[model samples]
Target: MSFTLAIVGRPNVGKSTLFNRLVGKRLALVDDQPGVTRDLREGEARLGDLRFTVIDTAGLEEATDESLQGRMRRLTERAVDMADVCLFLIDARAGVTPSDEVFADILRRRADHVILACNKAEGSAADAGVYESYGLGLGEPVRLSAEHGEGLNELYTLLAPVAETFEARAAADAPEVEVDVNEDGEVDADAPRKPTVDKPLQVAVVGRPNAGKSTLINKILGEDRLLTGPEAGITRDSISLTLDWDGMPTRIFDTAGMRKRAKVQDKVEKLSVADGLRAVKFAEVVVVLLDAAIPFEQQDLRIADLAEREGRAVVLAVNKWDVETEKQQKLRDLREAFERLLPQLRGAPLVTVSAKTGRGLDRLRAAVEKAHDVWNTRISTAQLNRWLTGMVEAHPPPAPGGRRIKLRYMTQAKTRPPGFVVMCSHPDKLPESYSRYLVNGLREDFDMPGTPIRLHMRSQSSKNPYKNKKKSTPSRLRKHIHGRGGAQG
Candidate 1:
């Protein structure tokens, strides 16, 4: 029930800039260059205590022909439809243009709520441009500089009521759900009900150049804080930004584009890739962004495999969907290919989006939240043991030293990919194949088909501490044997 706010504007109008301002991070790529952003990115945005989901949309353009621009426009239209409130932004320095008018008309017709923003209104020179924005006829324009971060208070005031109303409605519709873990790390089914809001959702955004990774984040944040360019490899660090997504607190990590190791020659690129790896390691859910035209490369597969190995939930995002043709067939083919090539992550959610246009961003967020939910799931020890009994009965363990090792007890040690520990007679003697079998069984039996399962075996040893300390020899026995033999003779 998170409220959603979308920032929509034509290219280079500071939509990403506004997004970054709201999210309080330089997560989106910011450049003076036009058409730098290409995707709709969503983030958890907070203004004072008013928290909600925010989307940074790609700059819109008029495209009636079956071209990339057309796709971008379609994507923008979708974002406007889905948003609870739409912030239509314009550059106060450059004055109003036809693109702005077209998009404004679209927003007026489609969006239920609209907030007109005159961005880059830092000086008196921008007053003319700001005044011209009144022609769009949305409302009194909130003149603010996304670059200088001026006039944010007015923006906050505008959004607070909308957010509060949304929260009230959500609370009324859904009963509170509480999750509790006992001393032994098992969830109590009958725990007292409370609202869910403790751990922050961990999300990692990763992709190749110009795939709109930074743009998407900026759009969600409502600011242009990150440096963006048309050139490849602009981001060299995995930057983390914490915010509220539809009232859900989340930490989103923006990572560098992963390339084939063989093709990586520069030291900077290597460092960037390494940093991205670290992000993947720490993230609970990884969103793999792909250019729709070149979706699912070998390197992409490698990255996805690495995430699986690290026990992270993965969400696949096909970026630049606005530019692609044959969308349905491509999505189907990519899914099939993923299943064939990376079956370990079967049923991993795939989302098609325009990081530039903000299309399918809400769905992307939903998919990520779902993946995270599955990732954090833990099974009860009793249930696990029961499942293990069935599995061991079906396929017995291999004998070691002419004796079959007995598995005495089992319990889930940790979650976030679900690790378990098993007590056995000989832990070291357990075969690799048997371990794989148990992992597979747990995955299949527990409805955790795609998630990685870790199984560890520990042996029990019993020994006395104070048994053998000192020994005394019977020395007189040898002398007595010799004397007795002589006397007898």
Candidate 2:
């Protein structure tokens, strides 16, 4: 079902609270403060068995000017236009204010389907407000407490028909397959694990505050889907959106700016940083965005390092490249800095692009795909053994305490950040630098660049055959020697 449900209302109406309840996660950053959400965040939401894409949008504001609130309001309105249904939420405790009524009228005109909902209606204190919601002319409101998880069944009941339509469409759109029936009425077996077309490639853009992450995303999306402004730390939620990028179905994440850990003071900012880290974990490819003027700050390095440590494929993007005067010199300097600062992410793609001007986006896209391919690269056992043999022969493992560490065999243990298991003698004694040599060889020889490689050195756990042998006492040794060799000399 591609249908989308957007939650919209004035600030602090529990719209985000309800969004979290539906998505079954704290994907949206919820706070007591108003206007926390400034962008449209989409998640796979399940209300009972009815599955749909749910959007957590910025609060609908009274302002129509180009202020921050105004931009936020515009973003929410865009969500209304894009969604199949809009869940118009209102604060039951506060009653239906003028702002809520104004948004109600806007939804009436824009949204094809609008579902009126009064949130925080858990007790009798909200009854008056719940009753007052009927005056907005959007029909009887669904009273529920988003935080307490009440009235979802009623909400599911309303959305069931829409879900049914989704199922019907899905069935209708399913591609026809040629069935091969045998004499026993058995069908031919397909591939054990076929790729799911509906599953989009997950990519995340992460960086420091005001690094143009949202702007870069908007450029890729070819629309101002996210709220972008000059203010630092404007994005509080790790918002996700799905789009078709150059013939590839991709789900992109716009994460909050991650500043230095000690500098993150506000509770909401901390939550936002946590949310971005979650997004990094969930993503297959992470684009570490950098401002062209200040390419590799400490925070930027930390974010990139975090992605690398997470075993995610990384693509380095220098945003606002169009504004850089010394393009060649800056590119060379950026590469050197990247190598020095993040040796772990060595050989990763570092493309320059201007998010504001949409320049070099094609190259950025190519780099991302290339990095993903490298991340998922797998080598055959025979090939890996050959490569390992060559690597060991070229520069053998070091000898410590007169015992040389021997690498006996090598095989790929897994892919998607390719991991290898090396069967060797005295694995514990093998130096880390030798492991780096093997990993670097694997990268260069197998053409797996910029992907995090996990090298596991394993030694057999078998015990020595004479481990339980009894030691000879002094008397026993003397008796044996005397009995065997008293007259032999």
Candidate 3:
């Protein structure tokens, strides 16, 4: 049984600090500047035998229009609505401001249960601010210093009761199940290891700024879960959500837009880009979203190449397709440009989509599933050796220094972006073009297009067994000869 707690307050009041402390990890990005967080990041939190989900949301601003701050405020409000309990934090050192008072009123009217906390209450400097917090009429505020890790015991005391109530409610609402006992008088709990309904496919949607990443995810979610506007670089964290995508269990990540290295001078943007890179590394499949009007730019090619180099199964998506007038020609040109620019990802699926209209998402999903399948593909040693024979017969390896490079044996070393090892003579002499040929053949013959394939060439040289053994001495030989002559006599 679990409940969700959303830490809400004005910007730079230590909401993310308290969130990190409660969750026992730095999952949420924190900085000295205000408004570093723009998305709702959720993590599992534990405190003194109490466990729950904690949401780190954007700061609650006074904006109510359709601007970036307004959208962020709306997103924070959504978090408040979803959470079972709300932790409204105020700056104890700075004292309660008008903004804090306003958000407190909103929480009072919105949240079912609210825990008012005065953060930065570590010394006498914050004493006056702590006392002034009583004017808001929420109750006695818990004195907390999230950075110094003080006052969490009191926070736990307040949370224990609420956690108990939620636990009881969950237990009552849960469906009953029967378990079978094995011969050893234990419950048979072993399950299959294959991907099933319980396990979800991990997919990360990544691209440059203003590429409609957040908008696309929102369309899939059928809600404005993330803050989005005409502004570039609105997202600064890799926000992930789980759902059944096209009847398949999936956990998709909406990552921050990546820009050229020279243009990213801010520390927060650097952290954001590093976070997105980490998301790509963890993902089994990466979707590189491109704007249809300007598809396959230098940055786009670099991003796709980055995914390929990281060994992530790649899927190309051209966004804002509805806005394009010459659909057929544009798609053809996009394909040609993709193949020419990213020859490594020659046969990868390229789908066109409109994040605003929710078009071609189904095809995108299918392409992702297929790429994942190919990424995890495993071929037998027998089939691989047979294919290697055909490849060698068609175009034999080059002979460097007049010695033929015999292709002896082939076997798959691993899967998940299938890697193959080839044992041959003078493997060091194999040219790059020849290696590319073998790789392309493996991709075509093995039906593993677009997925990166690893090919390793090694020389299988036989070592002499007696090379290091010392020869018998002349004295021992003479003694043996004398003994043989005496025996014969």
lDDT of 2 by residue, 1-489 (tens): 468899888888888888888888877888888878888888889877677899888888888898898888888888888888889999899998888878888998998999999999998999999999999999889988999999888898888888788789989999989967778985434212112348878899999999999999999999888889999999988888888888877889999999999999999899999999999999999999998887788888888888989999999999888878988988889889888989888899999999999999999989988887788786789988888888888888888899888888888878777889999889999988888888888888888778899999999645688798997679988999898897796
| Separate clash counts for every candidate | 27, 0, 0
lDDT of 1 at 428: 91
Model number with the top lDDT: 3
- C-alpha TM-scores of all predictions: 0.54, 0.88, 0.91
User: What are the lDDT figures for the candidates, one per model?
Assistant: 0.80, 0.87, 0.90
Error (Å) of candidate 3 at residue 161 is: 1.8
- After superposing candidate 3 on the true structure, give the runs of residues whose Cα lies further than 4 Å from its correct spot: 177-198, 464-489
Off by over 4 Å in 2: 164-196, 461-489
User: In terms of TM-score, which candidate is stronger, 1 or 3?
Assistant: 3
Question: What TM-score, to 2 decimals, does candidate 1 have?
Answer: 0.54
Model 1 lDDT per residue over 314-408, tens place: 89888888877888889889888888988778778888888677889899888887777667677888988888788778888988779998887
Q: What is the lDDT of residue 101 in candidate 3?
A: 89
**Candidate 1, residue 122: CA error in Å?**
35
- Pairs clashing within candidate 3: none
